[model samples]
Target: MSDNYSIARYLISQLRPGLQLGETVLSPDGKVLLYAGTILTEKHIEKLSYYNCEGVRVRELQSGVGMGFDSNQQRKRGNAEPEELIVSHEYYEADMAATVSEQETEFAGIYGNVVKDLKRCFTIVRLEKHLDCELLQSIVDALLTLSERGIGATALLHTATRSEDYLFHHSVNVGILANIIGNLSGAFKPSQQRNLILAGILHDIGKLEIPVHVLYKKGSLDEDELHMVRQHPAIAFKFFRRFKEIPESVRLGVLQHHERDDGSGYPLQTAGAKNHPIAKVLGIADVYDAMTSKKVYGEEVSPFAALDTIQADSFSGKFSPKYSTPFLHELCQTLIGRYVTLNDGSTGQLVFWNRSGKETCLIRFSDGQVIDIMNQNKLKVIKLVC
Candidate 1:
């Protein structure tokens, strides 16, 4: 309720070198402990840990481009002729704030840059015999940097409104998610993890050979079109064979990503023993990207809904329980602290997840009330909030 704060807020983690404090730091009881414009020092940040503070409010950070204090709050900074003060307030991440416009601007910056890089890489692989794996790694590195800062896949999914360049978008999305799954798999070697990411990048490369009309069709494909569509894995597999420099994991992953444990998958219909492990990772991430991304015919499903469909298939032996289950568990870990909109028209931060059951999640509302959503039978997390 105090006008003494900036609407743009930050977590304690954002307290890095060159971060200037924009407002007076206050105790929970409103007692001023630090003055306005006190540039945060290591000691000051270290003090926060002692207090067990979850986060701190600050003005825009004087850091980098697209980074800083909120310009809107700068109007209220000091003594002025008008002295207009803001009453009700909403606190949000300084980097990603309480404003829709601010979040959109940030997300657009990420989307445009990554999509451009992917387009270039896709073109390189299509036109040449050699693939620049480093360029692809650079894309994953950029996305990983954002994820390290807590602006991960869920945030991107929330910000994206449409799929303008669908292929590139899908490649980058699946790459980011595949790495997340691979890291948590506990069995994938570091090289295997890197290969998993590569697999995601090239998994759908064969689609390029398909006619644009069939590839981007807004309606169900005819039998002929469907048969052509399912040939993507084989197409990519054969194309990559020209480049002996490519990893076997990547080549086979490209070939087998659609292959299911139950043998109902496409191209080769390879299953179980024949399925490359990295392809299993690719399979899950691919389904997630497809479900949550805007398609020509249907709207994107929520992350939870996508998982529901995959898990159902997993139950029917479509995906290996040993593989798909862990992927789901680890992937869901990323959602623990994210905000979600519920079916009952309420919004909350996911505070806890019950390991024994998937449906029950503990969520904390804006008022700080934590509720186990499983008991609220009619309530389900309908979508993730940006």
Candidate 2:
């Protein structure tokens, strides 16, 4: 075995009955193979005897003794090829390690200077216009790297502080999500992707102008407070006008993200064709992060659930029809083949998309069993595991 082999690789051999440490298990050709982890109990020996395993031998590693099996007997029993077994172990280990590393990095990035920088942005709306160009570029670069690695930007949306820190995290997450949407939709060239990122980063700049109390309120807002909230887009637009170098697409996204396709939204209340494509994409990404985020008043919804809400609301004319359908479809497709932990504590991969229905499709086990959740009346998806 290679010195670098992971622990998972060492545990891949099939078990047989009566296997004992230090005893030689022989093949039909009298070759030795397979190792046992420890001395076999009578029950274990009986189980392997039923499988007709010849005998067990033990080999000790740095950690402990491993039981060995008869090679010829294993071949007859249809054991997986050694190469295939090793590859499977390696793949599993790599995936688990990457996930752990990502989680660590996300938590670390949430502290100290990074948090201070984000908090500063939240406290001053004008900072959006004056934001260090290099820093904005660095954030965009990091997002693109994450996309290439198939890591969800949502993983970076950490809420270490219960205050208005979510606003800062939300802003960053929206930026990353918007950039991803733009890239996936083919709405921009490589050169334009950064601009979309910037548009996403600044889309909610006007919210900084809202009183911190209103922004972080634990209670429901009254009608007058709600009206004040509606003026953010106009405030954002005014702020953007001061920066001549900012792209028009970015400026438009900041001003028009609040406007609905059906003219039900606020600020300018533009209808139909008036909303820009980048703005529409930004609006979708922004709402998704907000709805799925945990707050004082409510727990976060799953991403899949948020997607469903967006689709339902869009079909009801809450958003522009021109962009909503394609956007939702792409979002659903992006999530296919991903694993999610259901509320019932079962983990399964998302195998299908039910575009027309409320419940999505899932494949629950390794046996390829199909569960059409849309028709499964007793069960519902309660969470989306990253």
Best by lDDT: 1
Query: How well does candidate 2 score on lDDT at residue 118?
Result: 54
lDDT of 2 by residue, 1-386 (tens): 32322222222144333232333233354332221222343444554465566544343333443322222222111132443222223422332243333333544454333445655655444454465555555656665554432223443343332334676666666766777677666656888777777787677777777887786677789888888888887887887677676788888888888877788877888877788877887788888888777666557777778877888778778765455566666556445544455554455445455566464464332222345555555445666543
The estimated TM-scores of all candidates read 0.68, 0.64
| Global lDDT of each candidate | 0.65, 0.57
Q: Give the Å shift of residue 334 in candidate 1.
A: 2.7
Q: What is the lDDT of candidate 2?
A: 0.57
Clashes of each: 4, 13
Q: Which whole-number lDDT from 0 to 100 does residue 65 have in model 1?
A: 21
- Which TM-score value belongs to model 2? 0.64
